[model samples]
Target: MSAVGPAEALILLVIWVVPAVVLFFLIYWAVRLAIRHEGRRVPSLHERVTAEREAQRREWAEREARRNTEAPDEL
Candidate 1:
């Protein structure tokens, strides 16, 4: 009910803010480490997606070429 003093307010701030800041850093570092680990194993997300799309394009092109060369009876 009464107004809190400066020392009490600081204590309360530390009790609340310290853990929050620590938690934020912990999550940030965890995500960074996970990304680094994945990057070591393969390319980044954008590069991987691009590479996959390119591969699919080439495969489709090859298939189309093969189909076009085949006789109508093969259809």
Candidate 2:
């Protein structure tokens, strides 16, 4: 067989290197996503805080509504 020419080497490099990089990134991202999921517990701190704040707001609104209804209006 003849020695491989520069053109042939370039074509082979492109054929293999491009797909290898694409597959590397796909697996990398998949592993990252899996790892991120493994660390979670139910109601993460941020979620718990948000839920608590929302509950407080709801309770305050309910209390205001009850107070307004019970207290007579004074002109």
Candidate 3:
């Protein structure tokens, strides 16, 4: 049987080690986040929409005010 040469050994190391390290970190982060966000309450859809609409309204109001101030008044 042919023994693993240097190049084949490096390829084998890469194929095994990279994903194993990646998978370890993936699970680590998943658990960390799961613990971190365990009991946080997410905003409801209605609340999110209401906040977004209010922000949009304020932005539009500011934009309109700026426009009105910047434009020369028609005689």
Candidate 4:
């Protein structure tokens, strides 16, 4: 068989490279979108922990107040 010409080689390169590049970008964007969506769906661990601590503090304060009122004579 005769050797392939430059134009034919360039055309073949374009056909292969274009689709591969497109596919790469498509997958990249899909993963990024999934991560961003999941971030919005769930609360962060730090926020959850802070909220739990605040709740515990409020509970402790209420218990202390109740105890003080019940035993006003003690120092």
lDDT string, candidate 1, 13-57, tens digits? 899998899999999999999998887885679989999999999
Score every model by TM-score. 0.58, 0.47, 0.47, 0.48
Write the residue-wise lDDT of candidate 4 on 1-75 in tens digits: 999999999998899988899999999999999999987887789989999999999999999999989988756
Clashes per candidate (backbone, < 3 Å): 0, 0, 0, 0
lDDT per model vs. reference: 0.91, 0.92, 0.93, 0.93
* Candidate 2 lDDT by residue in tens digits, 1-75: 899999999998889988899999999999999888887747779989999999999999999999989996899
> Which candidate's TM-score is highest?
1
Model 4, stretches more than 4 Å misplaced?
1-3, 42-75
Off by over 4 Å in 3: 39-75
Candidate closer to the true structure by lDDT (higher is better), 1 or 3: 3
Off by over 4 Å in 1: 42-65, 68-70
List pairs with backbone clashes in candidate 3: none
Residue-level lDDT for 17 in candidate 1: 91
Q: Which stretches of candidate 2 lie over 4 Å from their true place?
A: 41-75
Write down the lDDT that model 3 would get: 0.93
